[model samples]
Target chain A: MKVGVLHSRIRRDEKLLLNELRERDHAVHKLDVRDRSFSIDQAGDQFATLELVVDRCLSSSRSRYLTAWCERHDIPVVNSATTAATCADKVRTSLALSEAGIPTPRTEVAFSIDAALDIMDDLGYPCVLKPVVGSWGRLMARIESRNMAESLLEHKATLGHYEHKVFYLQEYIETEGEDLRIVATDGVPIAGMRRSSDHWITNAARGAEVASIEVDSELETLVANVDAAVGGGLLGIDLMETQDGYTVHEVNHSVEFNALNSVAPIDVPSAVVDWLESICLETTAVSS
Target chain B: MTDEACIVCDATVALPADVELGEIVDCLTCGSELEVTGIDPYALEEAPELEEDWGE
Candidate 1:
């Protein structure tokens, strides 16, 4: 089997996957998106022979565009471009989850600062303002009052980036400083982890303490539903335990799992490779 | 093992035998983040800073 790992900087998560693939005697090609160029009608020789490409690009824009390019070249890539497109934008992810009847935090998008203020007024203070395209909990604020909202909105408006102008606001879910991250492929969960932190943002990159978690029947059902909603590939489904139950806050296409791997009972990288092998076999069979 | 100069401090930085490309290593003398750019002759360059869209 031949596998291509698309990445910019090789993080620990990518190293694990690459080691697993190499251990299985798979020909692993390291495709650095920054060093490579893609033509509309052609794929580089490095991409020509790989059976599958795993998108591990750190940049969301690069991931979205590179995956689409691979798809155009008829090369099978894990976490399809459709999934990438949907997960790349917070607004689109929220809409996809809502349209599928999946429980997600109440979210609204506003074009102007005034419109955003109006939505903020209705939702009241203590809501979350997130960048439409970002990860690791960066550029997210907990608006505690009208003054705070206005100050943040002014800064964002004047930042000059078109993305900053688009305000994505959501109701802040109280989770007691904890949340869940489940890694799945095609909707079936491989393993789960809990992120706990003193700060509001419980992202692993934010120094949240991580531990392995058990996926009960309810979470399993929701995971499957998320896969259906987001058009499965390799997905990281983030959920918060609410008074009602579990509510999905975000779905990540190119998810990192080094922390999860350290605590998970099963070898996460091995399980990931298992899924990749199965998909490769399926693709090969179809092509034959 | 390979020896290369730190792009930031020009100090000799030793790389591990299995160092992979784009692998980030901190310069012991200067504490600068250096990325492995080549394997044959062993080249090191300053790692780029993270961009806003760079995350999962």
Candidate 2:
């Protein structure tokens, strides 16, 4: 199988996957997003030749654009352009999850500071105000009081980017200072990790402690539901345990699994490569 | 007597008079991609690793 890895950097997260692909004797092509220059109207031969390309790009804009180009020119990418668009934007992710009847954080988006404060007030203190398009627990504010929310909103309102004006507010879940990240491919949970922190945010990148979580039936079902809700591919499904059950906060395309790999008993990269093999084989069979 | 140096090969390269910030310059000697990181000293760095978050 020929696999195209679209990336700008070969960090540990990427190296893991590449090793797995090579171990299985699949031909791996590395396309650096930074060095790559291609025509939108006509794809270059290198990109056009790949049977299946994995979108591991670090830049969201690059990922979306390159995947869109691939889709336009009939290249099958894991976590397709549609999925990338939905997952890369929090506002779109919320709509997709909620629309699918999945239990996600109750979110409200406002355009102005006043409207945002009003929504934040309604949601109450300790709620989260996040950038519509961001990751790694950056630019996320947990409002503890009206003054704080006001200040944050005022700061965000004045930012130059249009996305800053979009006040994405969410009702914070009462998780036990921790959350779950399940890496799934096509709605199947390949590995699961529980991330805990002294602070509210529990992202691994933010120094959250990660430990393996047994994939119970309920968790597996939620993984599948959340994965499908946001257009399934390779995804990092974030879940917060609620009083009733699990509430999905986000589903990530271009999902990273280096952290999950460290804690998970299963070899995540191997399973992922296996999945890629199946996708290639299936596509080849159908086309031939 | 241009002072711009390639970030990768440390070799000198001529920059266009109107070269702008964020412009990518390929190293003539090493062929490494260099990005204009600063202009005051006319500095360059091996292009910053391009990355974006997953909203973790």
Candidate 3:
């Protein structure tokens, strides 16, 4: 089977996964999405034949366009364009999760500046401010006061870009300085990790420490439900332990498996490759 | 100010720029409902602008 991995810089986690795929006799093609002239046909020619495309690139107009093209060509993508779009946008994810009856923090979205200002009154102060369509905890801020929230909202209004079209204000659920990252494939939870640090953010990119944890049956059920709700073949569910119980913080359709692998007992890369191979074989069978 | 069209609704009605975001305005021509897109062109210049500081 052949697979194409799209991203600008290949990180250690990605490298491990690629090496494992090669060892398993699966042709792995690494293509930088930034190459403006890069074509799927050209990249597919390098490999035996394109069976699936795994998008690892950050959210960008070009990356989004490429993923959409792959979907148009009937190429089985790990996380399709729709899932990526929903995952990339915090507001959309929150709304979808809410509709799915998945437990998540309360969120509100406003398109107009006046609406944003008024919405703040409803959400109250000390809420989190995040770009409606962002990831990796970038551009996420906690507005501790009304003045700060107003200033941030005004700034967002002036930008007039889609990224600033709306703001996501979630009721901050106080936690014990840690969160769980559960990785799943095809609605089956495979690995789990607990991230802890001094910072309020528990993102691996934010220098949080990660440790493997056993997946309890309840947690596995929650992870599976989230995976099914996301409809993404692979997903990363970030759950926050609150006083009430566990609430999903976010669902990452595109995740870097390396951090989770550091503490996980099983070889995640190999597992991911095995999953991809089965998907490829299934597609081949259906086509033929 | 009373003779000018609303910035969002295009109605022949005067309203302050700091009006509530949820206030709906009516189109005089089509009578269609319109809400503000939250942007105030007059305040555009006063907004804190940040140029892309790529690779400092």
Candidate 4:
């Protein structure tokens, strides 16, 4: 079987995954998403018929387009475009989590600046301001003062004239140590990492060191429910251990698993491959 | 751009200025609705460069 890995440069984990696949005697094709002319036809040809597509594209639009194209051509994409879209936007993720009865930080979304200001006033200070569509802690600010909130809202309002997408305001939870990184596939929590803290952002991209940790059944169930809600095959759930309990901070669709593998007890790559193989087999059976 | 006279009742007479896309304004005449359309003023402008170094 052959697999096509997208955005090879940005996701360094693709190399590790590809190496793992090669060791297992499966053909792998790495494609750089920055190549302008690398269309579906080119990707199909390069991989000599792709069994599965592993999307790691940073741009949501490009990722959606590619995944849709591949799906239309009978390729089994691990995380579909629909799932990616839901996971890419923080507002949507929060809504899904809330609707699924998962415990997440209290979040409010408002379209207009006035509405946002009102919400900020009501929600009180020390709330997090996050862009609707952002990743890796970009454009995420913790606003403690009412004046700061107003200034941020005004800046966003002045800049956003095309359309008013609601900005996310989440309640900030203080954590004693690093956050938990739970990696799940098919509603099953495979492995977890307890990040070593230096920064508030516990993302691997944020320079957090990884340590192997065991996830309880309750946490696994939470991750599974979230995965099902987003319709993603593989997901990364970031949870903060607040005084109340573990509350989900974010869900990532295009998660890089290199750091997780280094600290995980299981063979992370093998698990991923096994999941992809089952999905591919099912898809092939359905089509045939 | 049309020279058609304002049709709304109790409308204050005002000449229509060139409006770019996404700009919002209250109708001087009927105070109903006025939103700029057909051209994005900021479309051609380069996106403001972010200062964030996302650790590559």
Candidate 5:
């Protein structure tokens, strides 16, 4: 099958896929999205005769728009454009999860500082203040008091970016120094890891130690519900334990599995490529 | 004249005759990895940091 790789930089994740594709004897076309322009028609000769294109661009905006363009031209892209857009924005993901009755942290949004502070009141103190459009816990803060809330709001107001003022405050789930990062395809868990850290934020990128974990029945149910809510694709679902149960905080599009690869017993990248081949081959069989 | 000016300094760094996007070129003056973002006029941007972060 002819495979088109849409990427800006080749990280470990992409390198794994590229190597697997080569080993499998599939033709790989590396489409650097930075220099690729979208025409209303074919875009360019690079897109011709491609069976599947993977959206792996580093920038959310670029990946979303380019995938949309590909869809317009009747091309197939894994983790389609709609899924990318929904997963990229925190507010949209929240809405999708809430509407589907998925258990997520109690979250509130406000446009003004006063309204945000009022929301902080409803959620109570020690809640988290997070940027609406970031990952790996960048720019996320824990507001422990009303005074801190006021100061954060003031600081946020002075920022130039519009996203800064759109406050997304979430209830800080008190867990036992860990959270779950499960990599799954559609609704099925491929590999699961426990990110443990001394700090409140347990993201693997933030010096958290990673160890493999078992996928319990409860986790399976939650991820299945989450996959349905997010429209299904290769995704990373983040969950935190609460007094009630496990509440999913985020689902990432174009998820990274290199860290999970280290601890998981299963060959993570090979499994992913096998899944990718299955999907592409099945689709090609149908069309031809 | 297919060279692009180094983003670090105003010194010109010669680009390959068939420069493609995502190709990393080095700055002769400052020794920074420059990525080709454009080809028509040969534009370059500082290579993005490669640190793995929480998934996007």
Candidate 6:
């Protein structure tokens, strides 16, 4: 089998996958997105022979573009172009979850600062303001007061990027500084972890403490629904425990799992490669 | 093991016996994050700065 790991920097997560593939005697091609260019007419020699390519680019923009390019060249990519396109944007992910009748946070998007303020006024203070396209809790503001909201909005307005101008506001769930991150394949939960922190954001990237979680029947059901809502491959589904139950706040396409691997009872990367091998075999069979 | 010059400070830095490609190592002298772009020829480049759109 031939596998291409599409990445910018090889994080610990990518290294595990590469090592697993090598152990299985598969031809692993390290496709560096930083120093490569793609033509419309060709996938070029590096990408032409691979049976599968994993979208592991750190930059969301690069991941979206590279996956789309690979798709255009008829190369099979995990978390297909449609999945990557939808999951990369917060607005799109929210809509997909909402339309699918999945339990999610109440979210609103405002194009102008005044409109955002008005929406915030209605929702009251202590809501979250986020960049439409971001992760790791970057640029996420917990609006505790009107003054704080104004200051954050002003800074965003001055930042000058078009993404900053688009205000993504959501109802802040009182999870007591804890949340769930479940790594899943399609609709099936591979393993789960609880991210806890003193700050409001509980992302592992932000120094959150992680612990292994049991994938119960309820979690399984919710994740399956999320996979159906948004097209699935390898997905990181983030959920917040509300009074009602768990509400999905975000879904990540190119999900990272080094933190999970350390604590998980199962070998996270091996399970991932098992899924990848299945994908490669199916793709190969179809092409042959 | 390999000894390479820090791209920022020009100080001698000792790399580990087994450093993988794309692994980030910090220069002790200048504290700059350098990435291992090549292993065979032993190359180093300053890591790219974080962009707004860079995230998982």
TM-score of chain A of each: 0.98, 0.98, 0.91, 0.90, 0.96, 0.98
Q: Higher-TM-score candidate among 1 and 4? A: 1
Worst 10 residues of 1 chain A by lDDT: A36-45
Tens digit per residue, CA lDDT, model 5, A1-288 = 798988886556777777778889999888877665778766566686898898888777777787798889878887888888888889999999999999999999999999999999989989999887778878889999999999989998896378888999998888867999999887889989999999888888788899999999999988988888887888899998787898989889878888899999898888877878888988888888
Q: CA shift at A264, candidate 4, in angstroms?
A: 1.6
Per-residue lDDT over B1-56 for candidate 1, one digit per residue giving the tens place of the 0 to 100 score: 77888889899898987788988888999999888898887888899987999888
Off by over 4 Å in 5: B1-46, B49-55
- Residue pairs with backbone atoms closer than 3 Å in model 4 (clashes): none
By DockQ, who's the top model here? 1
Q: Per-prediction DockQ, in order?
A: 0.81, 0.16, 0.01, 0.01, 0.21, 0.73
Clash totals in order = 0, 3, 4, 0, 0, 0
Residue A53: error of model 3 in Å? Answer: 1.7
Tens-digit per-residue lDDT, A1-288, candidate 3: 778887644455566776788788877776666454656554344433678888876544444566777777677776778777667667777877888888988887777766766777777776787776555676777777778877888887786476676666777767757999988887788799999988777788779999999999878888877776766677888999877778998888767788898899998988888788888898889989
Q: List TM-score per model, in order.
A: 0.96, 0.85, 0.78, 0.77, 0.85, 0.95
lDDT comparison, 1 vs 5, better candidate? 1
- For model 6, how does the per-residue alpha-carbon lDDT over A1-288 read when each residue is reduced to its tens digit? 888888888777888888888999999888888787878788887788888999998889988888899899999998788888889999999999999999988899999889999999888879999888888899888999889989889999987598889899998888989999999998899999999999999999889999999998999999999998888899999998888888999999989899999999999999999999899889988998
lDDT of 1 by residue, A1-288 (tens): 988989989887888898899989999989887886788888978788899999999999998998899899999998888899899999999999999999998899999999999999999879999999999999999999999999999999997589999999999888889999999988889999999999999999899999999999999999999998988978999999998999999999989989999999999999999999999999999999
Candidate 2 local lDDT, A137-253, one digit each (tens) = 888888999999988888777764878888899998878789999999999999899999998988898799999999899989988888778888899999998888988998889
Runs in model 1 deviating more than 4 A are B1-5, B10-16, B28-30
Give, for candidate 3 chain A, the lowest lDDT window spanning 10 residues.
Answer: A39-48
lDDT assessment of candidate 4: 0.70
Model 6 chain B TM at 0.82
Q: What TM-score would you give candidate 5 relative to the actual structure? A: 0.85
Runs in model 6 with CA error above 4 Å?
A: B1-5, B9-18, B28-30
Ranking by lDDT: 1, 6, 5, 2, 4, 3
Sorted into a CAPRI-style docking class, model 5 comes out as incorrect
**Lowest lDDT 10-residue stretch of candidate 4 chain A:** A7-16
